[model samples]
Target: MTIIRQRLNELRRRAFAGRTGEIELFRSMLGAGGVLFLHGPGGIGKSALLDVLADVAGTASADPIRIDGRDVPPVPGSLQARSGSGRTVLLLDTYELLAPIDDWVREEFLPALPADAVVVIAARRPPSSRWLADPAWRELVRVVALRNLAPHDGRAYLAG
Candidate 1:
């Protein structure tokens, strides 16, 4: 990697302020098995949370596979192939772009994962009805609503 890219990543990590509760919650989810669904409006920090959690997953010995919905074609096969055969910490970003195959993902793809695998889905939209309607999913899923950072946290981010 270029020196600039490395520096940028370092800065990003350093600039990640606040979210202590969210980070703690994320750490708690790492050791256990289940899904974490983070949703909110634009620029609410869902993606940033996922990025930080990916690093946390690495420290926990879970291989993190990050797939941006915007980068891949809107096909289940493409997503499936990149999702690490259900053995890794799957970070699915920009889920709005992958909304077309939401059912396939929830019904077919997620079920195939290992019990120990961790899947974190970040999106602006709330999970579909099926996710909440299904009793099984209700047990395995945790929905965290991301809100705007506090004034102090925002200021800290800027100051960093």
Candidate 2:
């Protein structure tokens, strides 16, 4: 996994501005089996983080099922077929694109994921009330917010 580590370091340099917080966030999310939501404003590197995660997972011999929430598929069956593969890390990029999130979460993600899968989700905002209010849904998901990078870090990321 040395190459993966190197790639992560590079991604961190270019994407998160060498900020240790984002790296720590990624490390914590790695191998974690549950729903993970990363919410942040536009231009704050949310998509870049997802790309870094996918790159790292891609290099580790781990199967990655990256679904761009912007271009979400029509059928849940296709999603299931893709993510059910072994040792898969499924990333739902820009999750807010598919709002009314409960329907998508229930009909697609929850069913598509394997018991041991790691799910990473990046969103512009948290899900709607019906989703947030559900105890069962709350039980299964971990929410993380991405604040803007510190000034020095922001400069570093922008330098690239």
Best by lDDT: 1
Model 2 scores worst on lDDT over the 10 consecutive residues at: 73-82
Q: Which stretches of candidate 1 lie over 4 Å from their true place?
A: 1-4, 85-87
Error of 1 at 90 (Å): 0.3
Q: Candidates' lDDT values, in order?
A: 0.85, 0.69
Each prediction's TM-score against the native?
0.92, 0.74
lDDT of 1: 0.85
Question: Where does candidate 2 stray beyond 4 Å?
Answer: 1-19, 73-78
Model 1: per-residue lDDT, tens digit, 1-160?
4799778767789989878887787788776778888899988887788878888888888779999888998788988778674346899998988999999999899888887778889999989888999999999998888888899999998898
Q: TM-score of the candidate numbered 1? A: 0.92
